[model samples]
Target chain A: MKTILSVENLIKKYKNFKAVDDLSFDVKKGEILGLLGPNGSGKSTTINCILSLLKFESGKITIFGCEMRPDAYDIKKDIGVVFQEVAVFEELNVIDNIDYFCGLYIKDKEYRKKCIDDAIKLVGLEDFKKFYPKQLSGGLLRRLNIACGIAHKPKLVFLDEPTVAVDPQSRNNILDGIKKLRDNGATIIYTTHYMEEVEILCDRVIIIDKGKIIASGTGDELKELSKIEEKVTVEIDSLDEKILEEIKQFKNVDEATYNNGILFITYKKGKNNLSSLIDYLKKVDVHYDKIYSERPTLNDVFLYLTGKELRD
Target chain B: MFLHNLKYSLKTLFKNKMLIFWTYAFPLILGTFFYLAFSNIENSEKLDIIDIAIVDNEEFNNSIALKESFRNLSGENEQEQLFNIKYVDLAEAKTLLENDEIAGYLLVEDSPKVIVKTSGINETILKYVTEEIIQNEDVLTNIIEEKLNSTVIDGSIEEFIQNVREDAISMLDTSSLQIRDITSKKLSYTMIEFYTLIAMTALYGGIIGMTAINQNLANMSNNGKRIAVSPTNRIKIIFSSLLSSFIVQIIGLFILFMYTVFALKVDYGNNFPMIILLSLTGSLAGLSLGLAVGTIFKINENLKTGIIIAFTMLGSFLSGMMGITMKYIIDTNAPIVNKLNPVNMITDGFYSLYYYTTYNRFYFNIISLLIFSLIMIILSVLALRRQKYDSI
Candidate 1:
C-alpha cells in the first residue's frame, strides 16, 4: 500500500513541555491506523500538528506526496479532522451542522446534500436531523461531531477519540461507521484510549506513551510481545494456599493466585496449561465450579512491555 | 462559498439567544430608559421672558431718572421687552418673588441693587443687566437729559423715551434672552445625549462582531478549529461572518432608529442620509473592533465579551453618554481621544448634524469612523494571516 501521509521528526512543545517528541510515522493508503494511548498522551497533539492547527517546532509533514503547510489548502481539501473535543455548533441542528462542515469541502449543492445524507446515515443519526447539539445526549452528540467531520467525505480522515464516554451501542455504531469510511476508499487515522477498539478496528496500531511511539504493528504481532501465552480463570468456592502452590508447580504455570471462589493463573508459552492445572486441582481434591482459558489481551501485552496497565 | 458561509453564519448568530439579547434587547431596553430620562430635557432649555417688580419707595417714586429708566426698559417704547415690571411696594415685591410670579425685584437704593430668590439663567441675566446699568448710569442720564430738553412739551413723550432706551441699549445690549433660548436654530445640547445613545447602540454591535469572529477563530472555538482545518479560505470565512454580523447590526440599528424616532419622538433632524451613513460607519467600527479582539488574542468568549463591553462603555462615557459636558471637556482637554474613540466619532457626527451649518464636521467624523474600522480590520487580518498558532 502507498503511504498517504508521513511525518518525520515531528516535535511540538508547549512552554517547556514536549507534547510530541521526535515522532515519526506513516499512514498507509486505505488503512485504519489506530493511535492508541492513555489520557494525556500526545495522540491529540500529534493529530493537531498534522492538521496544521498547532505550530510545531520542527517537522516535515507530507500528504499525497506534497508538503503540508498552514496555507496548503490543496492538500487540506482532501483531509478531514474530528477533534477529541466535540466541535459542532450548539446553535445549529444536526442537518445544518453537517451541511455547514460538508459545504467547506463539497461546493456542488446536490452532491453536498447527498454526502451529508450519507454521513448522517453512517453515524446512525437519521432520526435526529433537526435536533440541536444541546438537545442530544452525550452519545448522540458524539455521533453528530463525527458526522460533521466526515460529512465532506475527504480522502483522508482523522478521528481523535470519537467514541470517548459513549455507550457500548454508540461506540459500536461509531466504529462501524469508521469501517464504512475505510470501505468507501478513505484512509482513517483513529486515536483513542480504548484498547478493545484498537484491537477490533485497527488494521495497523501505533501505541504511544509520553509523546513517543512505544510499539507499532498489527494487533497479533504486538500481542506476541508478551511472553505469557494464555490466561486462565477458575471459579471455585475456596482453595488452600498449599494447593495453589501445587497449581503453580504445574508445567508452564508462571503465576497463580486464588481468591474468594475464583482461581487465576497465567501460562508462559506452553500448550495444555489449562488442562494440566485442572488435573492438579482434581488430584488435590479441589472442587471447582468452572474453568476457562483465553489469550493475553493487548492490555496484558502493554503491561508486560511498559510495567503499567494500558489505562494508567 | 462566501454566500453559503454568510447564510449559515446568519442563521447561527441569530439563533443564539444570548447574542441576540446583547446586540438587540439589552440596547433597546437601555435606550428606552435613555429616552425617558431625556424626553423632557429639551423643553427645559427654552428661556421665557422674565417678570420682575420695582419697589415703590420714596427714592424710586421721587427720582424721575430711575422711573424713566425702569419704564423705558419695561417695553414703554415698544422695543423687545427685557422685563415686565410691576410697581409694587416693598412687601408686595417680596410677596411676588416668594410666589414665583417674578424672577426678582429691584430696589432704588444709593447704588441700585437686584435681588432674586434662587439662582438661574434668568436671575443671572437680570443681575448682570442691573450691574451694566449701574456702570453706565452717567451715559444714560446724560442721554435722557438730552432727550427731555429737545422734545416739545407733551404729556406723553414716548418718542423721547424711545430715544433714551435706544442709547441705553447701545451701552448694554440685551435683546435676545428668552425662557427657552434657542439662539442657534434648533441646536440643543440635550440632543447630544440622544446622539451618544445612538452611538452606543451602534457600537454595541461590537458584541455581534465578536460573536461572529469567535465562530471562525481556531483558538476561540472548536467550530473555529474545524474551519481552520478545512480547505476553505480563512479570510473569506471571516469576511462573510463579519458581513453577517453587519447585517444583524443594521437590523439592530434600524430598530433603534425607529424606536427613538417614532416611539420616543426624537427629532433627529433632516439629514437622514448622513445619519444612516454615520450609523453604518459606526457599526463597522464596532464590528472591526470585535474582529480585532477575537483574532488578536487567545482569550475565551467571556473575556472577549468583557473587553468589548469595557472598551465600548469607556468610549461611550468619553463621548458624552452620561452628560454632554463630558464630550466638551474631553474635546477641550484631549481632542485626540474623541478623535480616536469610535463612539465619540459617532456622537460627534450626529452633533455636527445638529450643531453645524455645514457638513464638514459630520464628514470628518464619518471618515474617522471609517478609518478606525479599517485599521481594526487590517490588524485583525494581519493576526488572522497565520493559519497556525503557538497554542489553542
Candidate 2:
C-alpha cells in the first residue's frame, strides 16, 4: 500500500530545548500505526508537527503530497484529529456539534444531515443527540469527540490518547471503532502510553524515547530485541544462603530475588530455564506457595529499553 | 460554507439561552427602564406662571384704562391680564414679599421698578418685562407730538407737549435708559418627543451591546476556529457578522420606534421618514462600533464586558448626553474627529430634527455613519487577519 503520511528528519526545538529531534516515520494506508512513548517523550509534539498545528525547525512533512499551511484546506479535508483533551462547542448539543464540524467539509444540507445521523449512530450517541457537552458523562463525551472528528469520513485519523480516562466499556468501544476505520481502508496514527493497547491494536509499533524511535516492529519482533527471555517465580518458605548462591551460579540466570516467600528468577535467554529452576527448587526442599512461569510482556520490554522508572 | 458557519453560529448563540437572555433580554429591560424614565420627563409640566405682588402708589387716581390693565394683572376676569397681581398697598406688598407669597412686587410709578424681598427668583425675565411695558409710553408720546404739529397756535402747552415728544424720542434713543420690552410667549412642546429620541438612542445603544457580545462569543467557539481555517476569508466573516448585527439592530430599532410613536404618542415631527433615516444611521454606527470592538479584542470571556461598557459610553456620549452645546464645540473644534465618531453622527442625526425641518443633514449623517461602520469593519478584518491560532 502507498504511504498516506511521511515525515523525514523532523526536528522541532524550543528556545534552548529539543522537543522532537531527528524523528522520522511513515504511516501507510489501511494500517494502525502505534506511536508508543512515555509522558513528555515528544509524542504530542510529533503529532502536532504532522497536523501542521506547530511549525518545525527543519523537516519535510507531506500530507497526500502537498505542503501544509494556513490555506491548505484540501489537505486538511482528508485528515481527522481527535486531541487528548476534548474540544467541542459546549454551548451546542451533541447532534448540533457533530453537524457543525461535519458541515465544515460537507456543504449540502441534505448530505450533512445523513452524515450527522451516521456519525451519531457510529458513536452510540443517538439517545443523547440533544444533550449538551456539559451534561454528558466522560465516556459519552469521548465518543462524541470521536464522532465529531470522524464525521466527515477522512482518509487519515489521528487519535491522541482517545481513551485516556474512559471506562473499560468505552475503551473497548473506542478500540473497536478505530479498528473499523482501519478495516475500511483508512490509515490511523494511534498514540498511547498504554502498552497493552499498543500490542493489541497496532499492526506495527514504534517505541520512542528522548524524541527518537528506540524500536519498531510487531509485538513478537519487539520481544526478540529484549535482553531477558523468561521470568520464573517460586513461592518458598525460606531461602537458605547456600541455595541462593547455587541459584546465582546457575547458567543463563541473570538475576534472582526473593520477597514475600516468593523467589523470582530472570533468565538471560533460555526456554527450559523454568524447568531447571523448578528442579533446583525441588532439590532444595524449600516449602513454598504457588509457582509460575511467564514470558516477557510489553511492559517489561519498555522498562528494559527506557529503564524501569517513571518520567515526566 | 459561510452560511453553514452562520447557521451553526446562530445555533450556538441560541443554545446558550442564558447568554441569549442576558445579551438580548437585559438590553430590552434596561431600554424599558430608560423609556419609562424619559417618558416621565416628557410628561413633566413646563411654562408655569410666576407669582408677583402689585403696589398701586396712586390709589384710585389712575385712569380707568390703567386701572383696568392693572386689575387684569390680578388673575381675575374682571382684573386679570398680565401678572397674578395681589393688588396690595406698598406696605402690604412689602409684607407679602417678606412672607414669600410673591417673588417680588411691581411698583407702578412714573418709571416702573420691581422691589423684591430677595434675589431668589429669575429676575432676568421680571426686569425685562417690566421695562418693556414702560417703553410703550414713549411710542404713544411720539404719536401725541405728531398731533401737536397740526395745532393752530404755537403756545407753551403745545410747545410743552412737543418738547415731551422730542424728549421721549431722545430718551428711547439713549443707550443707558431701560425700556419695557415685552417678551414673546413660547409655544409649549410635549415632552413625549424628547423622550422618544432618548428612547431611540438607548435602544440603539443596547442593541449594539447585544450584537457586540454576539460576535465576540461567535469568534470564541470551535466553529469560529473552523471557519477561520476555511476558504472563506476574514472579510466574509466580518461581513456576515455585520450583516447579522445590522439585521438584528434594525429589528430592535423598529420595535423601539413603534413603542415611541404609537405607544408613547411621540410626534417625531412631520418628517417621519427623516426621523427613521436618522435612527437607522445611529443604529448602524452603534452596531459597527460593537463589531469592531469584538473583532479587535481576543476572543475570551472579558471581551463581552469590555465591549458593552465601551460601546455604551461611546454611544451615549455621542448621542448628545454630552449636551447640545458640547456637540457644537466638538463639531467646530474637531470636525474630522467628530465626523468619524458614529455615536456623534447618530446624535447629530437626532439634532437635525430641530434645525432643518426637511431633514437637510439626513443623507450626510447616513453616509457618515456608513463610512464609520465601514472603517470599523475594515479594522476588524485587519485585526482578524493577524490572528493565527497556533495552539490553545
Candidate 3:
C-alpha cells in the first residue's frame, strides 16, 4: 500500500525537556494505525507535531509526497483531527457545529449540508441535530465532537482517545463508526492507552514509550514476542509449596505459584498443560473448582518488552 | 472561511450568558444605580426666590443706588426673580429676621451691611447682592465727586448727578447677578456620572473582545485548538472574531445610550453625531485592549478578564467615573495618564460636547482613542500571528 503520511527523526521540545524525541513512523494508505502509549508518553505531542500544530526542533514530515510545514494548507485540508478533549462549540447545536467546521473545508452550501447530515447519521446523532452541546450527555457530546472533526470527510483522520470516559455502549458505537470510516477508504490514525481498543481496531499497532517506538506490527505478531506461551490457572482453597514445585517439574513448565487460594502454572510451550494439571490435581485429591488455560495477550507482550504493563 | 467563522462567532457571543451578563446586563444595572443615586441633584439645584428684608431707615432712603438695586432684584418678573424683598421699619425687620421669615435683612448706613441668622446658599446670595450694590454705590459716589471737582458748578449740577446715576445703574444692570445660572441645566455637575458611565460602557467592549479572542487561541480553549489546525488562515479567523466582538460591543453600548437618553433623561448635548463617533472609536479601543490582553496574558479566561477589569476601572477612576476631583487631580498632576487612557479619552469627549463650543477637545480624544486602538491591535496581531505554539 502507498504511504499516506511519514515522519522522520521528529524532535519536539519544551524549554528543556523533549516531548517527542527522534520519532519516526509511516501511516499506510487506507489503514487504521494505532498509536498506543501510557499516560505522559508523548502520544498527544507526536500527533500534534505530525499535524504541524507544534513547533518541532528537527523533523521531516511528509504528507501526500510533500514536505509538511506550518503553512501547508493543501495537506491540512485533507486531514481531520478529533482531539482527546471535546472541542465543539457549546453555543451551537449539533447540526450547526458540524456544518461550521465542515464548511471550512467544503464551501459549497449544498455539499456542506449533505456532509453535515452524513456526519450526524454516521455518529448516530440523528436524534440530536438541534440540541446544544451543553444539553447532551458525555457520550453524546463525544459523538458530536467526532462529527465536528470528521464532517468534511477528510481522506486522513486522527482520532485521539475519542472514546475516553464513555460508557461501554457508546464505546462500541464509536468503534463501529470508526470502522465504517475505514471501510469508506479513508486512512485513520487512532491514539489510545487502551490495549483492547487497539487490538480491536488497529490494522497495525505502534507502541511507544519515552518518545520512541518500542514495538510495531500486527497484534498477533506483537503478542508472539512474549516469552510465555500459555498459563493454566486453578481455583483452589489451599495449596502446598511442594505441590507447586511438583507442577513446576512438568513438561515445559516454566514456574508455578499459589496465592489467594489460586494456583497458577506458567508454560513456555505445552499443548496439554491444562490437561496435565487437571490429571495431577485429580490424582492428588486436591479440590479445585475451576481450571482454565489462556494465551498471552498484547499487554503481556508489552510487559515483556518494556518491563511494565501497558497501563503503568 | 472568514465569514463562516464570523457568523458562528456572533452566535457564540450572543449565546454566552456569562459574557452577556458582564458586557450588557451588568453595565446597565450599574447605570440604573447611577441614575437613581443622582436623580435628586436637579431638584436640589432649582431655587425658590430668596425672601429678604430691607430696613426703612433715613440712610437707606439716601442710598439711592442701593435702593434701586434691591428693587431690581426683587422685581415682579417671577421667573427671573433672585429675591422677594420687604420694605419695613427697623423694628419690623428685626421681627422678620427673628421669625426666620427671611434669609437676611439689609441696612444701608455708611455702606450697605447684611445681617443673617445662619450661613447657607440663600444667606450667601443675599450677602453677595448687598456687597455688589455697595460697590456700585461707591463707584457712583466717586463719579459724582470727580464731576464736582473737575467741572464748573452751575444749575447743570443736578442734571449731571442724574446722568451719572442713570449711567452707573445701566452698567451695573448689564453686568448683573448670575443667581439664575444655578438652575437645572444640560451640563450639570452630577452628569459626570452619566458621562463616565458612557465611557465605562465603551470600555466594557474590552470584556467582549477578550472573550471573543479566547475562542480563537489554541492555549486558551479547546475550540481554539480545532481552529488552529484548520485550513483557514489564522489572521482571517482573528479578524472575523474581533469584528464579531466589536458588533456585540456596540449593541451593548447602544442599549446603554438609549436607556440613558429616554429613561434617565441624560442630556448628552447637541453633538449626537460626534458622540456616536466617539463611542464607536472608544469601543474599538476597548476591544483592541481586550484583544491585546487576551493574546498576551497566556492565562485562563477568568484571570484575563480580571486584568481587563482592573485596568478599565482604573481608567474610569482616572476619568472621573468615581469622583470628578480625581480627574481634576490627574489632569493637574499627571495629565499623561489620562491622555493615554481610553476611558478618559471617551469621557473627555463627552465633556467637550457638553461644555465647549469648539470640537478641538472632542477631536483630540477621538484621535487618541483611535491611536490607542491601533497600538493595541498591532500588539495583539504580533502575539496572534504565530501559527504554531511551543506548548498547548
Candidate 4:
C-alpha cells in the first residue's frame, strides 16, 4: 500500500516538557490507522505536527510523497481534519455550515453543493438542514461537525476522538459513516482512547503512552504479546482458601483469586483450562453457579503493555 | 475565494444578534437618552435677561452721553435690550446688590465705576458695559480739549454734546465685541455629546474585528484550528474576515449616523458625503485596533473582549464621551493624547465638519485615522504571521 502520511523523528516541546518526543509513524492509503492513547499522550500533538498546524523542534512530515510545510496548500487540499471539539459555526445553519467548510476546498459551486448534500445525508442530518448549531442536540451537533469536516470528500481524513462525549446511537452512526468514507477510498487516521472502537474499526492499531509508541500491530497480534493466554471466571455460592490455593498450584494457572461469590483465574498457556477448573471445583464439592473461559482481549494486552487501562 | 470567505463571514456576523445590538441598537438607545436629557437646557437658558441697577443722582444726569447709552441699551424690543436697567438711589442700589436682585449697579460720577456682589457671567457683562462707557467719555473729553485749543466752534454746547453721544454710541456698536455677537455661530453644546456617542459607536466595531480574529487564529478557537488546517492562505482568511467585519460595521455605523442625523436632529453639518467617509474610516480604525489586540495576545476570548472594551472606553472618555468639557480638558492639558487617540480623531473629524468652513482640520483627522488604521493592520498581520502554533 502507498503511504499517505509519514512523520519521522518528530519532536515537539513545550518549554521543559516534550509533548511529542521523537515520534515516528506512517499511515498507508485506504486503511484506517488507529492512534490509541490516554489523555495527554501526545496523540493530538502528533496529529497537529503532521498537519503543520503546530511547530516542532525537529521533524520531517511528508504527505503523498511531498514534504509538508505551513504553506503546502497542494498537500493540504486533499486533507480533512475533524477536531475532538465540535468546530461548526454556531450562527450558521447545518447546510450552510457544511457548505462553507466545503467551499474552502471545493470552489466549484455546483459540485460543492452536491458534495455538501451527500455529506449531510451521509451523517443522517437530512432533517436538520436549516437548524442552527444551538438548536441541535449534542449528538446531532457532533454529526453536523463530522459532516462539515468531511463535506469536501478529501482523500486523507483525520478524525480526532470524534465520538468523545457522544451518545451511543450517535457514536454508532458516526462510526458507520466513517467506515463508509473508508470504503469509498479515503484513508483515515482515527485517534481515540476507546479500545473497543479501535478493535471494531481500525485495520492497524498503534498504542502510545508518554509521547512514545508502546505497541503497534493487528488486534490478534497485540493480544498474543500479552502473557495471559486465557481468563476463566467462575461464580460459586461458597469457596474455601484451600481450593483457591490448589487452583493456583495448577501447572497452567498463573493467578487465582476468590472474592464475593466469584472465582477468577488467569492462565499463562493452557488447553482445556475451563474443563480443568470444573474438575477441580467438583472435587472440592464447591457449589458453583456458572463458569466460562475466554481468550485475552485487546484491553488485557493494553494493560499488560502499559500497566494502565486505555480509559485511565 | 476572497469573496466566498467574505460572504460566509458576513452572513455569520449578521446572524449574531448580540453584536448587532451592541454595534447599532445600543448607540441609538443611548443617543435618544442624551436627546431627552439635553434638548431643553439651551432653550430654558435663553430666556434670562441681565438685571442692573443705576444710581439716580446729579452726576448721572451731568453725563448726557452715559445716560443716552443706558437709554439706548434699554430699547423697546426686549430681545435687543442688553440689560433691564433700574434707576434707584445709591442705598437702594447697594441693597439690590446685597439681596442678589441685580447683577451690579453703575455709579455715573466724573469717572464712572461699576460694583457687584460676586463675580458671574452677568456681572462680567455689566463690567464690560461700564468700562466701555468710561472709555468713550475719556475719548470725547480728549477730543473736545484738542478742538477747543485748535479753533473756534460755531455750534451750541448742547448740540456738540449730542453729536459726541451719537459718535460714541456708533463706535461702541462697531467694536470687535459687538461684531462677535453679530457673527456668533449657532453652537449647540448637546451636539458634542452626540458626536462622542457616534465616536463610541465607531469604536464598538472593535468587537466585530475581535470576532474575526478569534475565528481565524489557529490557537484562538476550535473553528480556528479547522480553518488553519485548510488549504487557503492564512493572510487570505484574515483579510476576508476583516473585510466582512468592516462591511458589517460600516453598515451599522451608517444606520447609527442616519438615526442620529434624522431622528435625533443632530446638526452634523451639511456635508453628508464627508460624514459618511469619516464614519467608514473611523470604523476601520476601530476594527483594526481590535484585530491587532486580538492577534497579539494568547489569552481567552473573554479577556481579549474585555481589553478591547476597556481601551475603547478610555479613548472615548478622553474624547469627552462622558461630558462636553473632557475633550477640551484633555486637549488643553495633554494635546498629544488627543491627537493620537482614535476616538478623539473621529469626534474631532465630525466636529471640524460642522464647526469649520474649510476641510483642512477634517482631512487632517481623516489622514491621522488612516495612518492609525494602517499601523494596526500591519501589526495585526505581523502577529498573525505565525501560522503554526506552539500550542492550541
User: What fraction of the correct interface contacts does each predicted structure contain?
Assistant: 0.88, 0.32, 0.69, 0.80
**Model 3 Cα lDDT, one tens digit per residue, B326-381:** 67657756889999888899998888777655576679899999999999988988
lDDT of 1 by residue, A86-197 (tens): 9988889999999999998888999999999999999999999999998999999999999999988899999999988999899989989998999999999999888899
Order the numbered candidates by DockQ, best leading: 1, 4, 3, 2
- After superposition, the stretches of candidate 3 with alpha carbons farther than 4 Å from their true spots are B46-184
Report how far off residue A138 is in candidate 2 (Å). Answer: 1.7
- Cα shift from native, residue A212, model 2 (Å): 4.6
Candidate 1 CAPRI category: medium
- Which candidate number maximizes TM-score? 4
lDDT per residue as tens, model 1, B179-205:
121222343556777788788878878
By summed lDDT, the worst window of 10 consecutive residues in model 2 chain B runs over B180-189
Which stretches of model 4 miss by more than 4 angstroms?
B46-185
Comparing candidate 2 with candidate 4, which one achieves the higher DockQ?
A: 4
- Ranking of candidates on TM-score, top first: 4, 3, 1, 2
Q: Pick the candidate with the highest lDDT.
A: 4
Across B295-361, the per-residue lDDT of candidate 4 in tens digits comes to 9888997788788778888988898776655665577568899999999999989887886565766
Clashing residue pair totals per candidate (backbone < 3 A):
9, 11, 0, 0
Taking all chains together, the TM-score of candidate 4 against the true structure is 0.82
As for candidate 3, its clashing pairs are none
Q: What is the lDDT of residue B49 in candidate 3?
A: 75
Candidate 4, residues A11-53, lDDT tens digits: the string is 9999989888888889999999999999999999999999888
Superior candidate under lDDT, 2 versus 4: 4
lDDT, residue A141, candidate 4: 94
Write one digit per residue (lDDT tens) for candidate 3, span A1-312: 899999999998887888788999999999999998888889999998888878889989999888887778898899999999999888899988998888878889998998888888889999889999989999999999999999999999999999999988889989999999999989999999998999999999998888888989999888878888998888999887888888889998887888898888878885888887788988988998888888887788888889988888
